[model samples]
Target: MSERPHMSSTSWRRSQPITSGFGAGWVLVIFGVLAFLLPPGGTAQQPPDPVPPVGVAPAAVEAENDQELQTIFRSEISFVRVDAIVTDEDGNALVDLTADDFEIFEDDIPQKIESFKLVKHTGVFDPDLPPPGTIRNEFDLEREAAREDSRIFVFFLDEYHVRDYNAMRMMQPLVDFVETQLAPTDLVGIMYPLTPLFDVTLTRNHEQIVHALRQFKGRKYEYDVLNGYEAAYAHYPTTDVEKIRNDVSLSALKALAMKLGGLREGRKSIIVLSEGYTDYVPPQLRDESAGGGGRRGAMRYNPLAGNSRMEESTRLFQDMGMRANLVYTADIANRNNTSFYMVDPRGLAVWEYDMSQVPIDHETDQSMLRILQDTLYVLADESDGRAIVNRNDIGPGLAQIVADQSSYYLLGYTSSEAPTDGEFHEIKVEVNRPDVRIRARKGYYALTEDNATRLMAPPKPEPPSAVSRALAKLAEPTRSRLVRTWVGASRGDNGKTRLTFVWEPIASGQSRRDESASQVMLMAMSDNAAYFRGEVPSRPGGTLPLAEFEADPGELELNVAIEDEYGDVLDRAVDELVVPDFTGTDVALSTPTVLRAQNTMEMRRIAADPDALPTAGRYFRRTDQLLLRGEAYAPGASPVDVTARLLNREGASMMPLPVELSAGGAYELSVQLSPFPRGDYLVEVSAASGDGVATTLVAFRIQG
Candidate 1:
């Protein structure tokens, strides 16, 4: 019932370095509405639909066409999954490996090989997956009862800083790092945000990684502020620099991370790919003018935002038992030397404060670039993580990053570093050979994440209920979307009138965009009641275009109350609407008897978008229905062939209407109607579209 993505033409870029501090919320609280545990496996025995968590069932499992739910008792064992990349020491991605070739360790203590499986190649989620009877007891119902012991992710995209050419230069290293340097089972995703096409997607498959990389179009498309992606920035006036740049896209990064945190066995990791002071966000909207004044008129750095963002990025990582590693990227061409081959970390700088403009021109550039090379040493100098600074060795450099992402051993020890009840602890990790580099996260914020993850994770209660889900799915009434409302006046059969409103589909709440998924559920309510209902086949969620929304538009009634994902009723629409039933054999007429209203039957042509309504538009096409009720009725009240006239308010002829009223039925028909000019119009229903039914009279205005 749904469709796919509307691939737009935007590219990704490194965002301007915003310097404020804002943290992410908690993991558990954030994932409150998501599925806590995986569904059950199928058995020959059917069980009472596994009682939904907290009594809540899905709104309605969109029509299931391929599942076999017969006598099988679906086992409800939650499935745990994660993704990673693997590579050998020679900087080559290691493929064709089995689980037997690897070892598992949590907190440094090796654990048993519980489960292993390569991720699927396809990107879509299949309702009929893992097949039935697949869970052979890999789940621990008791352990899950406590909390999800899984991992979370940090999706870092370089949108503003990296230029196109420079970006292309880093692509190979980036991919190599993700595929060869990361672990074979670590979950991670990539996003190159300057372009909208640089969307975020998870890749458990190396093939997917490669495929996505190929789809990367080098040429940038033209963009205007009028289209998508502008509403957020246009309204949020973050004009100051003291704030972080996370809210610009309403990015689900934080939300997505929280959702993934519920996974059964993943680790916590933030894969950062930006080149900055790591997290050196200056406080306040800095006035680059005054050595330290806050941001200028329109652009100021966030005093607390930058540091806060870093704190959030870090704390979020810790809560999920993860650490962050920056695959610090720079132009290979701009490197101190285009060796195009081997290199050493000692030759570079660890933390480069680009003190370039002050004097030492050539000296500064060389020193800064070298400082970048050394930046990794300082990071890896003591911690398990190594910063790949101004890196020249694409193959080995990325291979190292991928290893860290996928298989680098995760070892946690009881920290001797106590809180100052608040104190930063210096963490340290090492491999047997000092000759080879062992990269890992520099430090951890310990319990600082408690507040972070908690704030983000909303409170979890019971699951949803069937009645609730059904109502949630029900699309009812005539919802008027500011941008998609199609309203006009026209006449019907019985010298009566009609108001046809064809609005684009509106869901109960904010709809999540699923690329390429066609089906969507639209719902509406009467401003008069508390229930929600859907019009049409109530198949609001479908793949048809907007033109498909109104086959024969009808309205259903429901409660006026509006609710959100949390089931919390927020507010209600202001005015109540009473709609006529188009289905019943008879309709109550709203016009007076012997109505001499002039009418015209006009055709409404959808010019721009047939399946959509604009928030604002000139009503350019409207068919008017002219009405005149002087046809003498025969004895015994026989049905009359109502001759309706579709005329302009000036009584001028417009279109010839073709409509009818059934025997013994009342109607609102059209004698003749044609599209009206961009303005107000009156509709007069005929005695029928042609026959016995009485006509209706309705009036409405259309905006240009």
Candidate 2:
């Protein structure tokens, strides 16, 4: 193993000194020493020991026959896997060591190593092998991520804890790291504090990652609401808002770790770009409201104001709560074999607060700076990872991160104690080679008896057929196409089917924007004859390009040519659709049309207009209401009963939706979205006439 000379911290200091009151060089020197002391491979100083676990209460044992059956269901041996990185004094990985050169222990008892292998990955694919495929869905992501040669990395950009200027300075380094340091096979993802874990997908498209990073803007002390989530708490006190931010970030971190754990048991990395976290805001900067201007008059600068007994107690409690949350987050990361590489974007930061923005004494500023940096250190150290702090040049630290994940040893063994008490067990790894440091997970928590039993339980039952079909509708359309289209069939005159074709241009952000879709040349043909052939010009706003024609009920083939503004075709597609037979004697319902409105007035207008255009979009904001319109028909004027109900993604009924008969004779179902959370839901509409019954489902997504 060879070490990169750029990994040295000695030359990371800035040439010029900070103009802040404190001596910036002195603070940098302290942090630099701290960084070198850990040396990336191992932590010389361990965090405070966690509290001992309490013993589980005794429980009655099962019958001998049942115990034997359970034993057959569960694994006879409890295996523990540990990933260790052995590096020499110069921080170069030692890959030559074998199982004979290493020893392992659990809870101070020596255990025999049952499995050992060197897992080395350069993040570069072999030229001899074909290039990997793009990750388009969850299946692709999971398959690619499971490859041993592919390294998974996630960038958790905590914008709430970083200043805008600092974030700008750090963006180039991040982009460079992704563009130059990473190979084409590496899987990378970028996430914000509020981004849902399901929304994150790791891909090899480095350009997309770079584009997202370029748009990064931090908001450390600023409290303007940018989205619906922030709007909920944007008016709170500054201190409370800070606490909320801290909670949100920590929770996101834990969730990411868990998500990676589910993906694979191999080592994964989450690089957190943040200044640091603090639950308590300094007195000088705290305002009555987060978005309000500074308090009236010159701010009081009392460095010792928080030193009183009451204030000190309050600070102590807040610190305790923050520490507890950090411990929980670290524990989750470790359990998932995920490492957190903390990077303070405010490289060589000298002051916690900008004097120009807020009036603060030097002492308070210095103290707050230390507290924030301490948090970064605690998180990194607890997770057996390194913290890059107080360094002007972060390129070396970033390189070291790649080096750490490039090569390592994976070892597994069955625990000698085989305890199922649901307690944390300490692990120790040692290498016989001289001058080599071994860094591995400190330990892992054992599963309780009940947990073990549940793990061995039978697989879950499959979802209902109706639920499965509804959820399947949530699958996204292929984004490589030029436009998104919708087709519907309803009852037509003279015992024929009325086929409606609607199309809209896909957003430029979602697809290639080289050419805008102007119109669609549509040709609908049945087995016997051509029903329609014409051009549908695109319209703006709520109205879209729509074409309707009467066709015989059967398989209809559609050839659509998407054209540009100049009438030149940009793309073409062929679709085979089954036109429903609404002219039959059985009870039947027409394909539902979804119309979105911002308020009741808009909804009423849509209901009144029989020919109002239906939206092709399936995504709606929480404030938007959807009106579903369709026609229910029965033979010989026999009255047809129509009803509607809301179902969750899993197919369970959430609530009953009333179906109203409009004066125009159209059955309409109005859905208010504000009461629902952000997710995919289904609206099931059914029509019944005597023994004949027909049903249809409409699925849509709610966005925050």
Q: Per-prediction count of colliding residue pairs?
A: 203, 0
Worst 10 residues of 2 by lDDT: 1-10
Please give the lDDT score at residue 218 for candidate 1. 31
User: Each model's C-alpha lDDT?
Assistant: 0.32, 0.76
Give model 1's TM-score versus the native structure: 0.35
Per-residue alpha-carbon lDDT of candidate 2 for residues 1-704, written as tens digits (9 for 90 to 100): 11011000011111222111222223333433322211111122223434334563223222443455555434332567788999999988998989999899999899899789898887678666656877876667767878877888899999999899999999999999999899887889999999966677898889999999999999988888899889988778788889899999998898777667656767889999999887866665566778775452223365555445665466567777877778668767876678899999989999987855655656656767887898898788777788999998999998888888888898887777777787878999998878888889888667677766665565577766756655554444444456667787788889898877888887876664467889999998977999999999888764777998999877778887888999998877777766778777877777788889988899889878878888777888899999998888778778778888998877778999999975323698899999999998988888787887777778788977
Residue 359, candidate 2: Cα error in Å is 5.2
lDDT of 1 at 461: 52
| TM-score of each predicted structure versus truth | 0.35, 0.71
How would you encode candidate 1's per-residue C-alpha lDDT over 529-563 as one tens digit per residue? 32324332212443222211122123322222233
